[model samples]
Target: MLKPSTLNNKLRVLLIEDDTIEVMKLKRAIAKLEMPHEIVEAKNGEEALDILRNRDSLPDLILLDLNMPRINGLEFLKILKNDEVMRFLPVVILTTSSNRKDMLECYKEGVAGYILKPLKYDDYVEKISTTLNYWSSNELIKG
Candidate 1:
């Protein structure tokens, strides 16, 4: 089990991914870990943008995948970074892509962290748990 953060506060996370399995894996991991964080899912960049635009309460963290159907992760990152209000929101690249170019670009585009998805279910869970635990300890800005 993952250790609880010092703040012990729940986080509203925006998870933008096109893969159904990936989404399910994350949800399952969260459930298994018994985290209290709220996850808001978006199938792609377009849908994520719509959610960001319309939602009254924005998410504290965004877990983005690089490859998607429409408006890929890089494009979405550009758009999000350009938005004055949304730019401050911490976005972490949670993707399968291990390409150095992609990693560098995401960092350039201002992602908080870049993580490659593990093939093993247990590893995946551990990575997600660690990431969440680290972020939860930080003083995240509420947007």
Candidate 2:
């Protein structure tokens, strides 16, 4: 079991994914890890932006999907990077897209990490666990 405090001062996550099935699976994986986290969900990048802009408490990390309705991931990343208040927040591109151009673009825009969504449930769980562990171990979570 991974202890959230061991990785950083605080643990919170904002996930922007449009797929309901994927969201359910992700929630199950998070539950299995028993890691302390305040998970916030958004159906698309537009909703995510609204939340980030209005919410008083910002998340330590954001897991974003590239393909979404109403403001895609790349557009959201651009807006976030430009904002003085939001630019510092770490963002990880979590999506199914394996396009080289997309990868390069995201890196250029300052994404902390990029992860391809796995097809299998177990594989997906492992990926999520590893990502969480890596961030925690690296102390990437904001205070």
Candidate 3:
């Protein structure tokens, strides 16, 4: 069992995004949040899955993009949901897709949250910060 304070301090975040520009924007937004987080970047779902499998400590949360080359977000979510160890970790769909079907499917597949990426830089910062703050303060799991 992981301690609450330890989990708070080492809140690992995995962002699976392919767009270089979006990645840069998100990185800056995350930096401005001023939280003690270890951010890991994955260009696509395959790489993210590889890291999740190989790493000893899995990320506390995953910010997943819906579309990408190789394995897409839905496919990756299916695989992760089926895995007993990984299923417990919260997966948030942070993508540009505003498709209703995609959003519905993501929820059906057990995504913890679905956030459409804000087009503006300032909004992006605020949204990310609020989301992270909420998750950090909440008692997600009990030891």
Tens-place lDDT per residue, model 1, 35-93, is 88999999999999999996578998999999999899999999999998999999999
Deviating ranges (above 4 Å) for candidate 2: 1-10, 140-143
* Local accuracy of candidate 3 as per-residue lDDT tens digits, 72-106: 99999999999999998899999989999999999
Tens digit of per-residue lDDT, candidate 2, span 12-40? 78999999987888899888877666789
Models sorted by TM-score, best on top: 1, 2, 3
What is the Å distance of residue 91 in model 1 from its true position? 0.4
Q: After superposition, how far is residue 13 of candidate 2 from its true place, in Å?
A: 0.6
Query: In candidate 2, residue 138 scores what lDDT?
Result: 63
Whole-model lDDT for model 3 versus the true structure? 0.83
CA RMSD per model (angstroms): 1.6, 2.2, 4.6
| Clashing residue pair totals per candidate (backbone < 3 A) | 0, 0, 0
lDDT for model 2? 0.85
What residue pairs clash in candidate 3, if any at all?
Answer: none
